[model samples]
Target: MNEANNHVFDTTTGEEQHLSKRNGSSNGTSKNGVANKIPSISEIKAAIPNHCFKSTIKQSMYYVFKDIILIIALYCFGHWVLQCNSIILKTALSPVYWFLQGTLLFAVFVLGHDCNHGSFSSYALLNDCLGTVLHSFVMTPYYPWKISHRHHHNNTGNMDKDEIFYPIRKKDNNKNSFALFFGLGFGWLAYLWRGFGPRQMNHWIPRHAIFAKHVVGCILSIGVVGIWVGILGYYVQLMGMVSLVYHYMIPVFICGCYIVMVTFLHHSDINLPWYSDDNWDSVKGKLSSVDRDYGIFHDVIHTIGTHQVHHLFPIIPHYNLREATTHFRKAFPQLVHINDKSIFPAFTEMFFKYSSQCIVENDAKIHYYK
Candidate 1:
């Protein structure tokens, strides 16, 4: 393979049609006597137009401001509507407000996500500043999440090392139900409280396994989140507990649900493959993601469902994902898999279908969820 912009490309072989038939003697090469040509991550990056990588402060800030404006406007509107004193009207509208507000908050999280990738701004400090503020507003610890999320991106489909959404072992019964119930309800919070996988880390603890490398950053993240919680506590004192629950807690809960649902669907699919560390390469691991279409909410929540390319090139701004994805599909048609199923039905289907079988045998080189 030819070298490109960021790094030199290695002429790597891709996954075989029958990966099980191939011995594990060679890395990135199929020993099954079949030719399987797949592009390297660098090769794919080169395929995307250079413009897609451009993330201007104005454009990025525009999205950040837009989401904030919508969220504020909705909160104000909900506040006014809550005054009507009609129990029926309030009951009908509260859920709608929660859904819209939650979705907009998740959109903010996506922008923070871009910031974490250093795609929100060319300046690293600015990215950190904005990322910390935006993520903390959504009650996530920015640096701690940034650290673990980097690991997640680096090892998306590697069963051994993936940080979040690691496949559950079959023998670990009822984990699926727990994942479905708790993961759907307060999964993100639980993850922050105690991480997933064998390590079972806590994102807030500076001395945790993945966290020890950047203890200072982790502490700063915790401090920021603590400040946010303090502000929320003061808000409760001023606005009363009922108002706090109605206005903030419920909406945040909805956003958490959105986070879990989108993340679970993005990685866990019946057709997606998981690889042993020995068999995993950047290209194969990245391709394991499923690009989804969320209809009207696509732009509302920032095309986070355009996940395949995002996994491949996390530096690409969220705004440019559609264009980058178009180029990506054209360049490597066979590699692209977009799930066009509607959001709720798709989540339901995959949630149940793969819930019990996401686990793989310890010795399996390549595994797919049943």
Candidate 2:
């Protein structure tokens, strides 16, 4: 380890603080006024073994195999439930089946994300091919999402240009308050429709190229549903639509809610600091993300709990996140951990906490405040 490794310190409150000379900040003072140092990238890297960074071909294959099995199981179970003639049995199994289906959808989303980062496979083309298929199945435009998602990673905590889900500053708080209520009820609809509206004409999405390549895929999805409707007849079609409303739409709504809520909680904490362009750099930007303890769901959904590591090395496979997080924790103890206990409280906490907050600086110190 270099001299930079000497600056790592675990705070009195058990939070990790890693100091690096590159960011031009020597130490961060906690709420208690105790100054803790941050660790350099080299120090963080040295703490982990060389093997942790290496992605094996075998490990990649394992993810592919697991994903295929889970998808088939989910589809087979859903088909069985849908084919049943007994209304009572179908009704009873609807929720269970939908939950299973949603799990499979979530896995698909994860695989697509991994592919976007080129972490799903050793070959970039193979990753893109798989990613496009998985993403289209879920009605997402692969290339569009991939491009925008890269912007999100590049500017995770920026207030002005972080692609999506950037928090409202103090001045924009009232505007956001109105949007929040409106968004809760029909946000997804707005998002989908926006692609066809004048908003798409803006710089974010070009006018002529609204869906572009995605138009074919979307039409294909509709055709598949149309064929199913033809075979099943009106009542079955109605039931299928109902099933979609309950299973697919409702769960997607819930997931979107969770995604927004969790993301707001992650970066909008009172303690975490957001930086202006002048004060921000790669190291500081990576440090801007917070970690959460997501319970057993962390394992099932992959290491989303190790968010800081994911921000630091977006290309690193989810399997390696835990090990990277362990190494990072050893160096910088101030890293946040929002677990079930923390998250549950956040339901009420979110309303008051993030409602009017922004990134502000005072006396050469940065903080998030209302």
Candidate 3:
């Protein structure tokens, strides 16, 4: 058989496929006896255009401008709602107004995330400056989050130690089945309070030192909240707080769920392989991560869906991720495609979808049964 046709196939499905090799390689022949090459992360990054690797000052400015516009628009909506006191009108308008507010907040989070990667600006300092302001406005500590997030990127699909969303192993899968449901509901609170809240000011990164220079920023935020309360009186503050909770906090929680669920489904799928200590390397660990096609939301929130490319060249700005992703897709057709349609369905399936997955192989074969 020709080299390309040497990988195995399932005749019943009538498509080319490769079974995971017992030795953690795709070097085996298919049922049709075709061979396939699974390109490494370096190989994929090398194949992409040079421009895709570079972030620009102009792009950063564009994101900052967009964020400003979103914030202003949200403020206008909130003001309009506050002016109207009719119960029916307020009830009906509240959800719509909050949806817009939540979406704007999500955009703010995306911009901050871009800055954290140093992809929002050509100047690293500028990115840090803007990121700190944007994150603090949203109640996230910029430097603290940036440091932990960097670790997450460095170890994307390592079964034993990915910094965030490390999947549960069979032995460690002691939680009752019902726990996953409650956990999903309260996941953001748990993530922020347990994982990030206490550690905010304690991390080694300078930005995380909130009690130092950033104490002023925290006090400023409190002052703004207090001033708004004083102007509108206690009842207005109460209503405003309710509005913020429903609009900002609740939707932030939903977005967090969306992020976690997507990340979990990406790496936790039945077909993807994870690595153990012996076989783990940065490139292999990242390639073990999957990319999803998030459809139109890709443009609205930025192209975070092209995650493999993000992992490969994190310096590449979100604007150029799609270009890099296209390059890799051409070179590696067998690469797993986890588009948006798969995400919600996977969430519905829940434990059946991702309960006991591992990154590496057992006795040379990719272990799926956990």
Candidate 4:
């Protein structure tokens, strides 16, 4: 660890306090080996160039238009493949089409993520409008999911409050293995239908406790999703079930897999810490995230894998995250946690170890996956 740069925020006074100043220990290591001090949000933000925080409508829309054009082109090519007489060729090519289509759709969801953060553009109405359309197309309820997601951001790594990818308490039964397995394909949907962790309210139900503060936004998102479903049904009727399955259902399932996997990976590492409210704060929660390298798909999904910086400063647009992350690492090298493991092998290891790693002591003020 970089002892000279180690610092923790004084939340009450909103000032930076060096860890060495608080105690005789020259380094900020706790008995458990985790760093005791974390950089404040302000300190991290000041490290990045101010231009990275600016979001322009034209620049954001360019990526949107680019994705839309590619999706259309892929759709056209897939349609042409449907007319091919060779069954072997279709069998060989189907998976390729599904992978590409689903990946791009997940990228679209990343764009919606920016909208929810108000990083896609300066206008609130514009952000809401784009978020609703993007999420609905990806089979998600926009504002309801957005509201819950905001809760997740605000309460990340908080044992009693985090909305998703929350650690399993040791006192709870080990039955979560099945739920974790199912999560890869349908977790996002399940979370929206019913809540996750300590929040038990349904996102689709505007009157649900989770949506109590944002009922109007929730209802509007639900209505938009309903309309999207109607359009999907009409498309199925016009194009037949096989076409719908080939082009829509399979790809949507693929996108869902990506969404769940990326989210789970960002928060569920075996070494990451979870805190009780007594020790939890926004700075600590944001630093709890891990930055993973997705290789070629990194930029394909809009640099979302550069997650630590995004969590620390979501106002930084996706396009500017890489530069912001560069500065963040230089500013506080010890604080930035990057997981360089290859995706497939890493996820496989985490999968088998999840039930064990996710369970933390029920009474501990700070918990780590054991």
**Highest TM-score among the candidates is held by which one?**
4
Candidate 3 deviant stretches above 4 angstroms: 1-40, 82-89, 170-185, 196-240, 340-342, 350-352, 356-370
**Candidate 4 residue lDDT tens string, 247-348:** 888888889989878887887665567788888999988888778889998998999999988998888899999999888866775565566678767676
Clashing pairs in 4: none
For candidate 4, give the lDDT: 0.78
Off by over 4 Å in 4: 1-33, 170-176
Question: Which prediction has more favorable lDDT, 2 or 3?
Answer: 3
List candidate 2 stretches off by more than 4 Å.
1-29, 32-37, 79-93, 170-240, 243-247, 335-344, 358-370
Q: After TM-score superposition, what is the CA distance of residue 353 in candidate 4 from its true location, in Å?
A: 2.1
Better of 3 and 4 by lDDT: 4
- Give per-residue lDDT, candidate 4, residue 39: 71
TM-score of each: 0.87, 0.70, 0.72, 0.89
Over the stretch 1-370, how does candidate 3's per-residue lDDT look in tens digits? 3345333322212234443331222433232212234566667767789998888888767876886787687667766875787888878987777655555566677788898898887887788778777765555566656766776677766555565545445454444443463265265445544442112333322343333554554444345444543544554466667655654566566556555665565555444555554556776666555566555555666766667667777888888988877776555544533333455665555445454432223333233322
Identify the superior model by TM-score, candidate 2 or candidate 4.
4
Q: What is the C-alpha lDDT of each candidate?
A: 0.77, 0.55, 0.57, 0.78
Q: For candidate 2, write residues 209-317 as lDDT tens digits.
A: 5346555544543454355445445544666676566545654554445444444555544445555555555656566666666665556556655677777777778
